[model samples]
Target: MNALNPVFYKEKIFSAAWFRTYGLLVIGSFVLAMGYTFFMTPYKIVPGGIYGIATILHYKLGFPIGMAALCFNLPLSLWGVKVLGKQFGLKTFICFILVAFFADGVPFLLEKCGHPHPYDPFQLQDEVLLASIFGGVVIGIGVGLILKTRSSSGGTDVFTSILSKLTRKPIGMLQMIVDSSIVLCGLLVFQDWKIPFYSWLTIFLMGKVIDIVMQGYSSDKTFFIVTDKIEEIRQYILVELHRGGSIMPVRGMFNRTEKEMIMTVVSRREMVTLQRAIYKIDPQAFTTILNAQEILGLGFKRLEE
Candidate 1:
């Protein structure tokens, strides 16, 4: 029984992790679908990716946006596997499928319930700009959640990767080129200048929101201090601040004098306290401070998380 305890706990941990990942995927897919069904599609905003093309088809040919995106995704995914020799994996396939189901199903249910405009149930037609902004934020949050699980909603990224391989262009550049072409297609189809502008705005906001979600709002700062009074500062950091840090030997380029440099990370408030203490300890100390976007280690966020 004692020997089996570790194995039992490991299984429990694995099960919990699996459940958490898939739960996030489901919630992310639903949120992404809501952003499209309510905020984006109704406004005729093409924010780029497979969904952007699907939006155009929905308006032009009366195709269902979610179904259209899936149709494009399937072939693209297969082609990607052939050319890139990379598997998108089951999680990615499931994510896009869930997005499709929720995207189409919700609107259909709304229509059956006798909503005046099933797509724009909130009547956001007159508020296109607001719709674009909120749509980006919501979509960003959804994508961020999906990404945290190391899965993706398989789409144009696969196509872009292929293009990158063929052209030997950077993947990031190819992605921009492909997305831009799709945005231009929307302009030509809709013949509305505002559509592209609003779509670009949505794209920009989504990118910003995604970064924020991934890194979180940082309140930690990193400090690199070069001082002759190394012992004084080291004691203050270890004893007073109760923080761990690294100390290294350094040589001044101007004076050719040997010195010690201390590197440490602390919270915003603690940074201020340390700054004052360092000033009092050594007025001539050279210090550089930088914002720490994410810190995962002892006395910070857990490595597992």
Candidate 2:
């Protein structure tokens, strides 16, 4: 009944539509956790988040690290759902469970295959570099995929969202601040800097790669034109570019003259066609261009809405 309780605030997770969403989060988290336990953790590499903390604890306490990670994040997950919303919280829960399940299960799978266990490689000098790089890469891709689907990996993600909402700052910037601190803490306390540094590198790489995957990797250019021959330019754009355009009336700041301002979005390859058409219509037309990192829908390739 609390105003912030996710179940009370939003639709419950039991809804049929959320089943697929939860399923993907679970699979993505499992892949990430399995990759970490089998490939990276055995090398003693610390990943970002409470998982990193769990690794540190497991090394010291002699308990199951993955299990400890689940316990550590359980309270945060509950609070995150209550404060963030039920749908989001439920998704996070799915990710957490999957990650935890993988963490506990992967070692057994590796052991049954007669492969050297994850912890065994920690004793090897060569493992320090290989684990750091490979673990970072696998985790990065896994995390990226999860993020692309609009799910959180819990831990600092929940806190970062809370902070972003509270301060009205962008979530990306908040995430950078929080993750940097986590990596720094891991480096300082663990007395080993390689894993932490690699972890930071992995986080950045994952974020950029995921953004490209979800939003698209293509770039677009938007042009604003103030021209004397509005009708002529408009027709050229329509016939040649096969794109849409809009015209806005504006007054020149210095000349105090009324004019029609044209705006349109075009792919990078279409720049030459736009320029040729504009020059043909009015040689002296004032023009400005802006860069668009991602273009979607209509004539562009859009990530699923």
| Candidate 1, residue 305: lDDT | 74
lDDT of model number 2: 0.73
lDDT by residue (1-305, candidate 2, tens digit) is 54664344333467754665566667678767865775556656665677777777777787676788788678877876777666465567778777888887766676787867544534446656566656666676677667755677777777777788779999888877877776776677768757666676656555665566555555689999999999888888888678897899999999899999999998889987898888888999999989877766677664444
* Top-TM-score structure, candidate number: 1
**RMSD for each of the candidates:** 5.1, 4.9
How far residue 140's Cα lies from its native spot in candidate 2, in Å, is 4.3
Off by over 4 Å in 2: 1-19, 38-47, 81-88, 116-141, 147-150, 160-178, 279-283, 301-304
TM-score of predicted model 2? 0.74
lDDT of 1 at 212: 85
Give each model a TM-score. Answer: 0.90, 0.74
lDDT of 1 by residue, 163-280 (tens): 8889899998888888888999999999999999999999999889889877787899999999989999999999999998999989999989998899999999999999999999
